[model samples]
Target: GCLPISIIGLLVETTHLSLVTPVGWWLLVYSTVVQFCIAYVSWFAALARLPASVAAIGTMAVPVIGVVASAIALGEPLGAGQIAALVFTLAAVVLATR
Candidate 1:
């Protein structure tokens, strides 16, 4: 909770930050709030109940999930960097699960 607030404050404090357009700031805030609710809080709860290795595999799904979501939500083309991230995430999951 406090960590998330701290992270948001860091994001807001960055001079490099700027909205892509008029509504971008609103969307940024909304998405950040939603992600904090869904992923961050839920993950913390899940880790408490599950083995750390199991929890880690579940958490590592994020990059792959993001790859698919970006395709759907943003119509973004998959690039080499993303592909690499996905591969690394997959390898990590496999190693951790094994």
Candidate 2:
């Protein structure tokens, strides 16, 4: 709610554009908005039901997944630092979960 409004407000202020999305970009933006809403709702429900420690540990994979997904989907290079960070993150999650 507030997140989308704040983002829209910022876009409006910076670009001085109307509340209209471009014709071709509307579907793409709509899809992204749907995905964000779904993820936000699911995350809220998960946090409500789960322990904070467990939720925090679960989110540790978010960055690792983001890096890997970007590399695969965007042809981005996976640097050694990213690989190391991912390994360390996985190790920490494994250890914490145990």
Candidate 3:
């Protein structure tokens, strides 16, 4: 029922995740949930400490972090083009937050 909708909710619901077993996948999701919980609290704290506009600017790094993490953790390919884009994006994000 909810599976299809949840699948749509995922950013990279692709062939890669299919290689892992159900239990292994659940463990990964549990770990991610824990990390997200920690990050959520920290981000909330950061929001309180900084101006909303500053927080908005800093939030742009989330995609860069996601790409790097996914490439490292899942062995996803981060081609030269993608790497260049990530670098530029992050550089822009740094400039934006400054």
Best candidate according to TM-score? 2
Q: What is the lDDT of candidate 2?
A: 0.84
| Residues 1-98 of candidate 3: C-alpha lDDT, one tens digit per residue | 97988888785565666679999988888888987898889889989999887887757988888899999999999999999999999889878777
The better-scoring model by lDDT among 1 and 3 is: 3
Q: For model 3, what is the C-alpha lDDT against the true structure?
A: 0.85
List the candidates' TM-scores in order. Answer: 0.56, 0.61, 0.56
For candidate 1, give the lDDT.
0.82
- Model 2, residue 33: displacement in angstroms? 3.3
Ranked by TM-score, top first:
2, 3, 1
- Clashes (backbone N, CA, C under 3 Å), per candidate, total 0, 0, 0
Off by over 4 Å in 3: 1-37
Please, what is the whole-model Cα lDDT of each candidate in the order they appear? Answer: 0.82, 0.84, 0.85
lDDT of 2 by residue, 1-98 (tens): 78999998887776534655697477767688988898889888889999877887758889888989999999999989889989999998998887
Residue 95 of model 3 has an lDDT of: 81
**Of models 2 and 3, which has the larger lDDT?**
3
Evaluated at residue 40, the lDDT of candidate 3 is 89
